[model samples]
Target chain A: MSVKNEKKFNVVYGEAVGAVAAHSFGEPSTQMVLRTFHSAGIASSVVTGLPRILELVDARKKQQSPIMTIRLEKSYAKNYEKAKQVKAQFEEVLVKSLLESFTEDLKNVTMLLEFSKEKLAQSDLTLKFISGKLQAKFESIETEQEGNKLKIKYKSKKEMKSARTMFVNMRNFAIKGLQGIKKATVQQDDDGEFYIVTSGSNMAGALEVDGVDKEHLYSNDMFDVLKVYGIEAARNMIANELKKTMDEENVSVGFRHIGLLADAMTYGGSIKSAGRHGIAGNKASVFARASYEETVKHFVNASVFGERDPLKGVSENILIGKQINVGTGRIKLAIKKEDLKKVDAEK
Target chain B: MVVHEVLSESEAKKVSAEYNTPIDKFPKILQSDPQVIKIGAKPRQLIKIHREDPTGKYSAYRYVVESV
Candidate 1:
């Protein structure tokens, strides 16, 4: 079989945008975030705008802007993806650690405060230290807006729960530095760390006992706003790419179609599946055989697994859908030699 | 002299950038009586943080960046 004829890989592409980097995620957080990574770009790109992420990165390095390349020896853990994962992992670890430390059960952990890994204006040891601390679990973290103040609803559990008790616990936790936080001139940790919740700056090493969480923070749109921002900011770039792709391939696709394609690309960069658990619960066979089994676990109800709905509602393909053994119909692939020869002769 | 100090995961990076050094090449661990060898007159590729200055900055001590 010809590889190109295979539908294993669906290149769902998107454009890079910003609230600023022309169309990259370099935009500040004050801007609106996209719901799904702009899909409208990639479907068009191979057809108009540009190529895709791989191609986009290539074009960027070739640009005449002196290539804003910062040479670091071995800091692979500092990229947007790695950093975001690290932050997320840290939250998990922090909560688990805190629960273990306090010998208490875990609560509904929420990332009350969030900042873009790319938006930090400057970085230093101090910022890293403080961030490391915040990434540690402090019980309950929620994003709330109170007039102009960003009320980071925090609830810790080294003890009991009460407004005054929570406040006192929070205040005490503030005073005792988490070992190696950064020192600031007008330290905000005095009142708390929530005050320093500014964008384009890392919260590491910037906190002290004197810091106030409220003082440092402004009204945040959402904790995971950056997630949307990063995806949406790619709108223009997505549009241009989709335009190019569709035009080149002569495949007319609307913004909605491109949007679906973009979402797949941004998250996993494939367009061969759809529905609720399409990418989340189960991956297609193309991803890997292991992915197929995972998909089975995600969709079908087996004796091993209780009854479950396959998110394959939108991903049903009759030609090669390897889901069931015997359902409404049967799939027979054992072809005899005579049938094969007869079919070949007809073709 | 090689400035040896503690750096956060991010600062550890900026420090390397400032020095045009690779992160993998940065001094990270302490050896028990580390075998110090002088390769010609060039300095040793080592960055050790003093016990006191674990804050990752210029502390009350001074050290030379030497090569083994």
Candidate 2:
């Protein structure tokens, strides 16, 4: 590498990078839009702006709205029909979604389920498919199908309460597609290539579907990325996601600061939040941990464990009004034995 | 995943000596990690990762720890 490039990448020892990263993220975040805008149609509502920054930093297990952008294989990407077919494999269909109305005939101990023909057509499912799935779920119950309806007869006539419970259970039964995925929509990207954007994320299951571009699949959920792709990918995701979120708000920040933050968060081989419960909480010095959060808890634990603070870190030294160990404060004067003998004690 | 290679025992020792740190003290990667599993690495092994940065490319080292 060139000297200039080497210098650009090297962080000076004793430089407070954590403080710099914090300031870099903190200043621009003030200008971020507070409101989250929901796009029309079946597209997932993305959490953006200041809220998104918090979501990434906190590393929340359950996202407000997790989304995934699934790319297709080369042959399928150029065709709209192929992309739609892939989308159907991800969008889940529930029995209740296709039902028009369900009526229970207590006298006959039967339930009449009215299926909406329009919904069935839109979902690309037939009466047979639905009936077959229902039959598999309840083998003992007898089912008779009409034009757009099915009549289910319970074996035991007098058990009215059990029949009511069965109705609730049948409605929630998933007939097809990956579970947890609420909806999937096929969209055309800038290059006229078709892809699928889903409201929910099921990375492992989605990867199994045909025509999916396994290498390029992306999810907004950090845990999913960590679980599927491992630590390095998760680290990159954090930095890229942070940069993308900032770009959407028109805020300009250097990638270096964001990269530094990401490296610090994942250098320990796992994603850790920047605050109290994670990185901050794991500081080696008791005083540093106490100063950040849960002050009394940290102090009591330290005392109980007979923990000693070396007073090496910035926070601990600052707490005692000593110079922080950074920049010029990092320099210490040393007197050689011969020089010490030469120095006047009185002076 | 980034481009990575599992180092031999001798190579791992050389890295540990060069960095002036013990092998176990290095940053850890779980043995069950997908990338580690893909590479078929075992516990107490070392991995050298080639990372691409906008400024330049650099190598990072990780120690494989048994998954608990």
Candidate 3:
């Protein structure tokens, strides 16, 4: 880049870019409605509007509803059937889901589970596969399979409470698919490419699926992205997420402002909230930290540690009613000791 | 994600001198970060990142911290 162009693009020294970015976000955010949208009965409802903005900025570990969009490889992307196969790997199928009816013989200490043929056929699972899984999971229990019905009996006599516990465990036992993923639906994009949308996110596990487009696999969960990709990717996700949320609310904000905020949050190698627990709490000036939140705690700690306020930041300087070190206030003039000595004390 | 490259000892020293800042004082990237692990960078090392924006491309530096 040329020096002139670089100078034009460069942020002015001591410019209050952070303050500007904060205001940019804060102003548009007030107009956003507190609404979460549900997409029919297939995909999960995403938290949007003001609540989502707060969640992203706060760096909350657990999102209210995490979702993933798993794209497919070139060959699989055009066919719905092929996409369904990939989607099946993520939709968790439990033992109870395959059963037509479940009955327990309390006197004989045996549980009879009748498998639904239609459910088994739809899931592409065989009777033997389920029986084998059951035997592997419960070693002490002996399973007898006759046709589509399987009978489970305890090796030793157990109390009613123990029998009930065993019944509940057997009913909820997972047969196939990745854990943490509740549902996966194959949806077509605007480009007519088939992609899987899952209610829960498991990026690592989703990547291991056969036809998944690993490069394009995206999760709404920020921490999951951090774990699978890294800080830089997380930073991009933050900016993109913020932009997307605002767009959903029909609010337009400059991407530069959002990018600046995202950079501030993740530049420290980890996602830090903009609130008192993160950026504000870690300020260098004691007065700036005290003025943010937990006023007494900050002052007490500063006193005990004998901390000195640099009075360089805007907040600290403002607190003492001084010109903030920004824009024109950032300029200072200095005269060398030799130059001063050259002039007489009094004219 | 942007491309990341681990700086050699000499290069790191040169960067420190150019920036007039200590190596440890730069913005940090965790040692366990996926990109760091991919490039096999150790703690206290320096990473040069190449990022693209709407304006153009730019380079940023990060100091590899053990955690946090």
Candidate 4:
């Protein structure tokens, strides 16, 4: 490379590119209203704009909505019936949805359950299975399937109050599908390929579903991705999700800036927010820490811990009115008369 | 053993001295980068990436400092 090219590509010393990146992202973001829009027909249709980006950068533990997209295998994706079967497996079925009505007796509780011949056969659910599941929890329970209605009688020594609570508990018991996932539906994408979209994220459990395409599965939650695919995948997810949200809002920010932010968030091998509780609050320089937030707290901690600030960074140097160690400030020149004489002699 | 190893304190110091660049200013690689994990590289360690052109006649060298 020529000296001219080197000068062209070289970042000016003390330029504070961090501030430049911040301005690039923040200026356009001000024009965007902090709102989320809904898109119809899309399974993962939540379009949270700037607020979502803030949450990601801050590395908030809880998000507004956590969703997962589970793509099925090639064969299953072509068949509507196969996709429905997979979706059913992801549904969280409660015992309450199965029961019609219940009455409490002195020593036994009697319950009536509505049955659908076609639906039961489709879900592979039988009265025998339900009875066995109930019996597993309650010792003395009997079931009688009469036509379309099934009656359950529970004989336990517990009192009426506790029996009623037990009855409520039994009603909420899961008969099928994975827990945590409230709803799942098979939706066709732009390519006409079918995949399951879930309301709640349960990556590990959803991956266990038969015919699920492990490689293509995606979740909105960064931690869930980290738990299943390790840190690299999570970092990529952060960048991609952030970019998608930004693009939806019609705001333009360079991908490299977002990549840099993601890299900062996960540089420690663990994901951290750029908030007070994470990186900003834990700066090495005392002035830098005090400048961000909770000024007194940071000062008090530094004082009590006998911390010393070297004042090497841009933030601390700017705070204390010192030249920051960047750009031209990074270079130190010391020329002696003897050295000048030597140079003159060499010439 | 992992192919990527975190450079020891002395090794990191040596690399910085050789390049005559501050460690912080070195080209960055994330701790979550797959190649960094495969070699078990950590923050502040210098990583050397060697690649060859598809034609097999050209080669390239790049260095990255792992950061979190």
Q: What ranges in model 2 sit over 4 Å off?
A: A1-9, A33-44, A95-174, A345-347, B17-19
Q: Second chain only: TM-score per model?
A: 0.34, 0.91, 0.91, 0.58
Q: Positional deviation of A207 in candidate 1, in angstroms?
A: 19
Off by over 4 Å in 3: A1-7, A33-44, A94-175, A304-308, A336-347
On DockQ, the stronger of 2 and 3 is 3
Among these predicted structures, which one has the highest lDDT? 3
Which structure is stronger by TM-score: 1 or 4? 4
Quality of candidate 2's docking, in CAPRI categories? medium
Candidate 1 chain B: minimum summed lDDT over ten consecutive residues — where?
B32-41
Candidate 4 is scored at a TM of: 0.66
Model 1 regions more than 4 Å off: A1-258, A263-315, A319-347, B1-68
- What lDDT score belongs to each candidate, Candidate 1 first? 0.31, 0.84, 0.86, 0.72
Local accuracy of candidate 1 as per-residue lDDT tens digits, B1-68: 12233334566556667767675554222121121121111132333332211112322111124211
| lDDT, candidate 2, at A174 | 75
Q: How does candidate 2 fare on TM-score?
A: 0.78
Q: In model 1, what is the error at residue A329, expressed in angstroms?
A: 18
Candidate 4 residue A336 Cα shift, in angstroms, is 2.8
Which digits, one per residue and each the tens of the lDDT, describe model 3 over residues A1-347?
54446548667767899888889888877766433333224353677677788899999998888899988999999998999878877888889989899899988889999999999999899988888988898888888899999999988888988888988988888789875688889999899999999998889888899999888989988999999999988888999999999998788887778988888899789999989989888899899988889999999998999998878789989999999889999888899997787776544
Q: What share of the true interface contacts does each candidate keep?
A: 0.00, 0.50, 0.78, 0.11
**DockQ (model 4, Cα):** 0.13
> Which scores higher on lDDT, 1 or 4?
4
For residues A81-198, write the lDDT of model 2, one tens digit per residue: 9888888888888888889998888667788889999999997899888878888887767789998999888655657777777777777777888766898999998999999999
